[model samples]
Target: MSTLSGAPAPPRIPEAVHRRRWAILAVLMFGLLIVVLDNSILNVAVKTIASPEPTGIGATQSELEWAMNSYTLVFAGLLFTAGLFGDRIGRKKVLVFGVAVFGVGSALAAFSGSPGELIAYRAVMGFGGAFVMPATLAVVMDVFERHEQPRAIGIWAGSVGVGMAIGPITGGLLIEHFWWGSIFLINVPVVVVALIAMALLLPDSRDPNPGRMDPLGVMLSIIGLILLVYGIIRGGELANFSAPSVLLPMVGGLVVLVCFVLHEWRTDHPAIDITYFKRPAFAAAVTAIALVFFALTGVTFFSAFYLQSVRGYDALEAGLLILPLAVAQMVVALRARLIVDRFGARSVCTVGMLLVAMVLAAFVMFDVSTPLWVIELVLLMQGVAMALITPPVTVSVMQSLPREKAGSGSAVSNTFRQVGGALGIAVLGSLLSTQYRGAIEGHLSVVPSGARQAAGESIEATLAAAERLGPAGKALIGPANEAFLHAMHLTALVSTGVALIGALVVAVFLPDGDPEPERESAEGAPGRALPVSGR
Candidate 1:
C-alpha cells in the first residue's frame, strides 16, 4: 500500500478510517493540552508554596522556580531527537508510551515530599512530554488531507489557548480548596481518559524510509539547549557581572551550540534538518514564531506572579485575572484558518505581532499606584494579538514543508518556539529580578539605615512581613511595592522589544500566498502522476 510510486493507485479513503483519524486527533489534543497547561499553572502557585516555610523546602522562591524550569529544560532538550524517533518507530506507539510516562510522572510530582523530589519528578514529566508533543502533531499531519489541514491546525492551536485558559482557573480553584499538590494530581484523570481514547482511535504509522539516529547530534542539541537556558535563568536570577558560575555555563552553552551548528552543517541527514533555513519562508516563519513565544511566555510567567505576589490575589483569583488572555487566544485560534486563507501568513502575523508589542508597551506603564482595570485592559489587548498571531504562524510553517517530512518539519518549528519560550523566561525573568533589586535598593535608600539593612537582608521575608505591617510599615511598603511593579514594567518593555523584532522578521521573511500545502498535490493526472505528497 505504499504511496511512494508515482503510479500507485490512489488509496481509497474509507469512512471508518476518516472517523478514526478525527477521533485520534481529539484524544491526542486532550493529552497534549494537559501537558501545556501544567507549565503555566505552577506560576500562580509559586508564592503560595513559598510562605511560612523559612527553609523554603515545600515552597521557597528557588524551589518554585525549579518546579517550572525543570520541566521546560528537559522538554526543549529532547524535542528534536524525540521527533525523529517517533517518525522512525510509530507515532501511536510513541504517544501511548509518552502518555503513560507523563501520567506516572505527574503522580510522582503530586506526592513529592521535598523540593528535590518535586524537581526530579518534574524532570521526569518533561521527558515524557518531549515524546508526547512531537508525536501528536506528526500524527495530525499524517491523518488529515491538505485541504483539511488548516482547519485542523487551527483547532490544534486553539488547544493551547484552551489549556492556557484552564490552567490558571482550574489550578487556582484546586489550590484554593485543596493543597498545592492537587494541581499536579489533577493531570491523572485527564490523562487516563485521553489514553483510552488514543488507544481506540489512533492508527499505527511509521516512516516508510527512515534514516539512522544521530547520537552525536542529539547530544549536542541537548547540551547546547540546557547550558543556554541555564545561563539565561542564572544571569536573570543573579545578574552579577563577575560571577564565574553564571558566566561559565552561559558561555559554555553558547560555545556548544556554535559547535552544534558546525556539526549539523557537516552531517548527512542531520538530526535537525537545519537546511530548512535555506527556504526564506521557513526561516522567516520560524523566527517570527520564536519571537512570538518570547513575548507571550514572558508575559504569562511574570503576570501570573504579578497578580499573586504584587496584588495579593489567591491562586484562583490570579488565574481568573489572566483568563482574558486565554479566552481571546481561543476565539482567535478557532477562526485562524479562515483568516489565514484570506490575508496570508505575513499580513496576519505582522498585524498580530505589532498588536502584541503595543499591548506589552502599555503594560510597561503600570505601577503599584495604577488601577487594576488598566492592567486588565492591556492584557486584553495582548490576548487579541496572540489570538491572531499563533495559529497563522504555525499553519505557515507546516505548509512550507513537504508532507513526507511533516513530522520533523513540525518538530523543528515547535523546538524553536520552546527554545524561545525557555529563553524568554530566563532572560525576561532575570531582567525583572535585577530591576526589582535595583528599584528596591533605590527606594529603600530613602529609609533609615537600620530599616534599609533589614530590607536588604531578606527582601522576600520582609515583603511577606510587610503585608502584615500596620499603617507605618504599610507606608514603608508602598515604595517597595512600587519598586516591584516597576521591575515588572521593565520586563514588559523587554517583551515589547522582542515582539517588535518578531513582527519585522515575519514581515520580511514569511512568504505571501495562500498558505502553501505541506502535503502538495500530485502533479499531472490519471496514470501519469506523482505520488501523494506523503509516503
Candidate 2:
C-alpha cells in the first residue's frame, strides 16, 4: 500500500510464504499495542506514586491531575497535525522518527527527578504516540486491500484490547515490587523491537498530493484541545457560577475550535481536511467509537478506585478482579469481524451500544456491600460489548475512504476517541469529587476543626478513617460512604444515557453498505459491501 510518486507497484510477496502483508500487519499491531497500553498502564500506579520522596512535596490533587492529563492532552492535540505530516512525508519514515522520540521520552520519564519532570516527559511521549498511531492504521490500509482488511484489522484491534486489559495488571505487579517509573521503562524494549520490525516489514506510503501544511490550523487545534481538556479536568474547582479559570478555557477552547473549522473551510490544505465529515457513514462510525471509549474510560477510572479504596483490595487483587473484563473483551473481539461479515457494522454497532447501556445500568445497583458476582457480571458484559463494536466501526471508517487519505482518516477517528476518554474521566471524576467532598463536609459538620478536607482527596479516606474513629465518627463515615457510591451510580447512569443516544444517532444517520461503482472496481468485488456472509 505504499504510495510513492511515480513508484512502480511493489512486487507482491508470494502467499506461499504466508505473505509479507501479515508480517507488516504484525509490526503495526505492535505499534497499536504500545500506544494503547501506554494510555492505561499508569492507572494502577497513580495511587502508589502520588506522593513524592519527602512524603507529600509534590502529591497534591493538581499534581495527580498533571500526571494523567499531561499525556492525553498532548496526544489528542498532536494527533491531527502528526497525521497531516505523515501523509505529507512518508508514513514509514515518520513512524521511525516517532519511535526514536518516544524512546527518548520514555527514558526521561523513567529517570524523572520530580513529578513536573515526569509530566514534561509524558507530553513528549504523547507527541511521539500521535505519529505512531495514525501511521500504523494507514500502513494497514495500504498493505491490505479492502476485502482482506477486516481480518487484518480484527487481529490488530484484538491485540489492542489485550494490551489494554493487561496494562493495569502489569502496572499493579510492577508497582508492588518496583517503583512507579518501572511502567515507563518497560516500554523501552517493546519500542526497540517494534522499530526493528517496522523498518524491515512496513512499506513506505504517503499522500500523492499532500499540499501545504497549515501552521494556523495546527496552532488552533493544539491550543483548543489543551484548553478544553484542562477546563474539563479542573471542573468545579473554580467559582460556582462563572469562574475565569473554568470559563476562560472552556469557552475559549470552543471559540478556537470554531475558528479551526472556519480555517479548514477556507484553507486549501487544511490539517484535518474537514470535508470528510460530509459523509454520514464516516461521521457515525467515528461517533460510535468515541462513545465506546467515553464509557469504557470512565468505568476503568472509577472501578479501579472502587476496588482498591472501598473493597480494600491490593493492586494485584484489584487487577485480578478486572481480569474478567479483559478476557471477555478478547473473546468477543475475535468474533466481531465474523459478526460484521454476516450482519454488517450497522447492526453490530447499534446492538453493541445498547448492550453497553444495559450493562452500565445493571451496575447502578452496586454498593459497598454488593456481592462480587454482581461486579463481575457487569465487567463481562461491558467487555463483550466493546469487543463487538470497536473493530467493525473502525474498519468501516478506514475502508470508506480512498487509500491515500487513510492516515488522515484514521487520525481523525482516533482523535475522537482520545478526546472522549479525557472528557469522560474529567467530567465523571469531577462529579464524584464534588459529591464526595460535600458528603464528607455534611457528615463531619460537628468536628471541632470545622471539617478539614480528607487526605489525598480520595473517597477512600473516610472509609479507612472509620477503623480509627470513635463511635460517633464511625456513624458519620457510614453516611459518607453511601454518598460516594450514590454519586458513582449517577455517573454511570448518565454515561448509559449518552451511549444510548449515540446508538440512536448511528441508526438514523448511518446507512447499510451500498458500495458505489467507483469503490466496487477499486475494491475488486461486487456486493462484498453487502451484509457480511458466514464466518
Candidate 3:
C-alpha cells in the first residue's frame, strides 16, 4: 500500500491491546449498544410519552417526532468533526469523554418534564453519540491488524442490529414495570460500566498528522439539516406545506446547504469531500443507504403505534411481537458479508432492496385486525432485507473511494444514514399525522368543538378525548383505530415506493465485487482510521 507523501508514521499498537482485542471489541460494542439502544427504546416508549400528564409527558405527535429527530440532527451533523477529534486527540480519550457526556445527557433526558425539554436533552445525547460512534470504529482499526479486520468489522456491524432489535423488548420490560423515564435512565449504568472498562481495557491511538479541522463546514451542515428537518416536521403539524413557516425553513435550509456545498468545494479543509460522489459506485451506495433508511425508519416509527394503540397490545406484548425482527437482523447481519463476498454487492443489495420493498408493501394490507403472525412475518423479513443491504452497501462505498479517503467514506456513510432516518421520521410521521387528522376530523364531533382539532391530531389524541367523554367516548374508539390504520397503511405504501426506487438505483449504479486488497482498506486511511465495514 502506498502512503501519502510526507504523511506521519502510523501509531504503534501496544502489546496489551493486541492481547485483549476481543475484550476491547466488547468495550466498543458497549458504547455502540447504548447509542443505538436509546433510539429503539424510545420507539416503544413514545406511546407512553404521548399519554396525558402524570402517567406520561402529554406530548403531541409533532413533539414526539421532534424528540427523536433532535438527536439524529445533532448526531449526523457532528460525526465528521468527532471522527477528526478522535484522530487528533486519541480514540480512548474521545471514547471515554463521549460516554460520560452521553451518560449525563441520558440522565437529564430521563427526568425531562415536557416534550420540549426532552428534545433538548436528546440533542445533548446526540452530541455525545457523534463522538462515541466514530471513535469506536476508529479504535477497532487501531486494535485489529488488517487480516482480522473484516471479521471484527462483521461482528461490530452485527451488534448494531442487536442493539436496535433488543431495545424495544428491553424498553417494554422497563415501561411496563416502571415509569416512562426509566427507559432513558437505564443507559446510565451501562455508560458507567463502559467508562470503567475504557479506563482499563481500551488502548489509545491517534493520527500523528490529523490535518485542518473543519468547524465552518460542520456548523453549516448542522444548521442546514436542522432547518430542513424542522420545515418538514412543521409542514406535517399544520398539514399545510404552503404555509410560510414551512416554506421559509425549507428554502432557507436548501440555501444554507447549497452554501455548505460551495464552501466545501472552495475550502482546502472541507469536512466532507463532495468530489467523492463523482464515483458512481460510491454515489449509488450512499443514496441506497439514505433512501432505505428513509423508508424503513419511517415504517418502524409508525409500527409502534399500530402495535400498541390499534392492536391493543401492552408495551411488553408489543416488544415481544417485534422480537422476530430483532432476531432476524442479529442473525442475518453476521452472515451478510460472506454472502456478499461470494455473490457480490450489486446482486445481493439490489435483490435485498426489492425484498425490502415487497415487505413494506405488505404493510398496505394491515388493518386493526390484521393477524399477529402476519405482522411478525413482515418484520422478520424486513430485518433480513436490511441485513442484506447494510454490509455490502458499506463495503461498496469504501471500495469506490481512494484508500487514503476512507475516513471521509465512513463518516459520510454514517451521516447519510442518520440524515435519511431523520427525514424518514419527519416525512413519514407527518404523512401519518396528515392522513389521520383528515380521517378522524369528522369523528371528532363527538367531543367539544374546542377539543375537536386536538382529538383529530392522532389516534391517541382521539382516544384520550374519548376517555374524557366516558361512555360516549367509546364511540370514538372504533373510529380512531380505523383512522390510524388508514394512516399507517398509506405511510407504509409510500415507504414501499421509496424502497423500490432504492432498488432501481442499486441495480443501475452500484458496483460489483468486494473491496480492494486488505492493505488498501481503511486501516491505512489518513486521519483516524475508518472501520473496514460499518455500523
User: Number of the top candidate by TM-score?
Assistant: 3
* Model 1 Cα lDDT, one tens digit per residue, 331-398: 88899878877887788889999998999888777755568788778777777798787777776777
The C-alpha RMSD of each candidate to the native structure, in angstroms, is 3.8, 5.3, 3.8
Which candidate model has the greater TM-score, 2 or 3? 3
Query: On a 0 to 100 scale, what is the lDDT of residue 173 in model 3?
Result: 93
- Candidate 2 structure lDDT: 0.73
TM-score of 3: 0.91
Tens digits of lDDT, candidate 3, 115-211: 9999999999999998888787767766776556656666777787788778988999999899999999999999999898888778776655547
Task: List the global CA lDDT of all models.
Answer: 0.74, 0.73, 0.81
Which residue pairs clash in candidate 2?
1-142, 341-532
- Pairs clashing within candidate 3: none
Model 1 bad stretches (over 4 Å)? 1-8, 12-15, 53-58, 369-372, 442-460, 467-473, 515-535
Model 2 ranges off by over 4 Å: 1-18, 51-62, 236-241, 445-451, 454-456, 461-480, 514-535
**Structural similarity to truth (TM-score) of each candidate:** 0.90, 0.88, 0.91
CA lDDT of 268 in candidate 3? Answer: 91
